[model samples]
Target: MLQFRLIVPADLTDEVAELITSTVGATHLTLLKGAALDPVGDLMTCDVAREAADPLLAGLRGLGLEERGLIAVDSVDMSLSRRSDDAERDAPGDGADAVLWDSMAELTEDESTLTVTYLAFLSVATMLAAYGVMLDSSILIVGAMAVGPEFGPLAGICTGLVIRRKQLVARSAKALVVGFLAAMLVTGAFAALLDLFGLFSRSQFERPHPATQFIWQPTADSFVVALLAGIAGVLSLTSAKSGALVGVAISVTTVPAAANAALALSYTAWHEVLGSAWQLALNLAGIVVAGLVTLLVQKWVWHRQRGRAAATSPPAP
Candidate 1:
């Protein structure tokens, strides 16, 4: 459930109260008349089930409350009221399936920004993978995969595409591109440093590393894995099953492939560089495509659910 706090204009107090009362999954409305000093209106609060939040928020926005007043939403971890339970039961769909689009947009916007912390995480992950690749250590590779922050911008790009936000797409794309490029370059320089310390050698990298071969070998299965990961990633963000994101993080070889590409570049291994780059591109494309499709389907399903609810609802006299 979500809790909403609104400062409503004096004239719209009745309309706001009526809207909340009529909403199927909203309950516990509290109105304080003329309580907002700055806005000089009423202070109203209500609880709404997640499934009904989008439409309720849309209704409020349509009333010009956003421009004239203030709207704030927070998650409710626990609600002891029986009406809250009834509200959840009466809502059209499951709370876990609901997509709080406004919240998501804000989330992705923050995550997709190109920040120092983002770069630091990506670079560290890439360097770790560089060591893993040279040493042919699966443990280090997996650790690097978990540490990589590339998924944030990838998800941002997918969300932006589904919501038709061009600026979001641009920002996310820039973050993805610059983050990877910068990380790979840093990894390449780090690999050269390892060579200087006699810790890395061309022959060591050329040795058959059976466990880590998938990082450089682009097969159809690579794209398939990426597609599945993308679906899980988006589901994690939109739904309540966020823990699945760890599995999604480790399942893709994006960081490993980037590390391999950087290592191969340091050694002037054209074939390895090309193969790893192909693997990286294939995984990224698959994740983006799958995420886009998943979000579109979710949006469609929720729209239909709302339509069905509206059709069955009795007219308000």
Candidate 2:
């Protein structure tokens, strides 16, 4: 279940209360009139089924509460109220399957930003992948993939496309491109330093490593794997089942390819660099395409469900 704390203007208190009471999946409503000092409004709180949260939030936003007041939502890990159970049971769909769009937008908005932490993680992941490629260790490659933060920008781009938010698209694109470029450059320098210390060699990269050769080899399978991973990744994010993301992370070769490209550049291996770049581009394109399609399908399904719910609901007095 989702809990909402809303600060509403004094005049709109009755209207807001009526809306919540009429909502099928809302319960445990509480209101403290004139309790909001800063906003000078009433403090209202309620719990709603996850499936019903989106519409309820939309209704509240339509009332201008978001502009004049505050709307904060939190997940209820444990709700002891019988009304909460009833609310969940009466909701249109299962809670886990419901897509809380507002929540998703907020999540992706924060993740897509190019923060210093993001750059640090990406750089470290790329460097780890470079070592993994040199050693031809699948385990290290998977580890690097798990550590990479590329999926955030990918999801952000998909969300922007679905919502038609140009600013989000621009920001996500910039983050992805700049982040990858910066990571690759830093990993390349790291590779050169390792070579100077005799810890890495061009001969290692040129060796026939059957286990890790796939990182620099672009093929149809690369796109297919990335496409499948993209679907799973987006679903995990939308459903809030984050554990599934680890599997998605390891399924794609994005970080490994970028690492391979950087390593090859350090050794002046143009052919390997080109091949790895191709692999990176192919995987990225496939993921973004698949992610966009998955989100679009989800939006369509939810819209249809919302329509059916509205049809069955009784008219307001």
Largest TM-score belongs to which candidate?
2
> Residues 1-317, candidate 1, lDDT per residue (tens digit)?
89999999999989988999989999999999888998788999999999999889989989999999998999899999999999999888778889988777778888899999999999999999999988889999999999998888998999999888999999999999999999999999999888999999999999999989889999999999999999999999998677888899899989999999999999998999999999999999999999999999999998888788778877768
Residues 1-317, candidate 2: write the lDDT tens digits.
88999999999999999999988899999999899998899999999999999889999999999999999999899999899999988878667667877787888888899999999999999999999989989889999999999998999899998888888888889989999999999999999899999989978888887888988888999999999999999999989899998998898988889999999888888988999999999989999999999999988888788778778867757
Q: Which ten residues in a row have the lowest lDDT in candidate 1?
A: 307-316
Model 1, clash count? 0
lDDT of 2 at 149: 92
Q: Over all chains combined, what TM-score does candidate 1 have?
A: 0.94
Candidate lDDT values, in order: 0.92, 0.90
Lowest lDDT sum, 10 consecutive residues, model 2, at 93-102
Candidate 1 clashes between residue pairs 3 or more apart in a chain or in different chains: none
Candidate 1 residue spans exceeding 4 A from truth:
9-12, 33-41
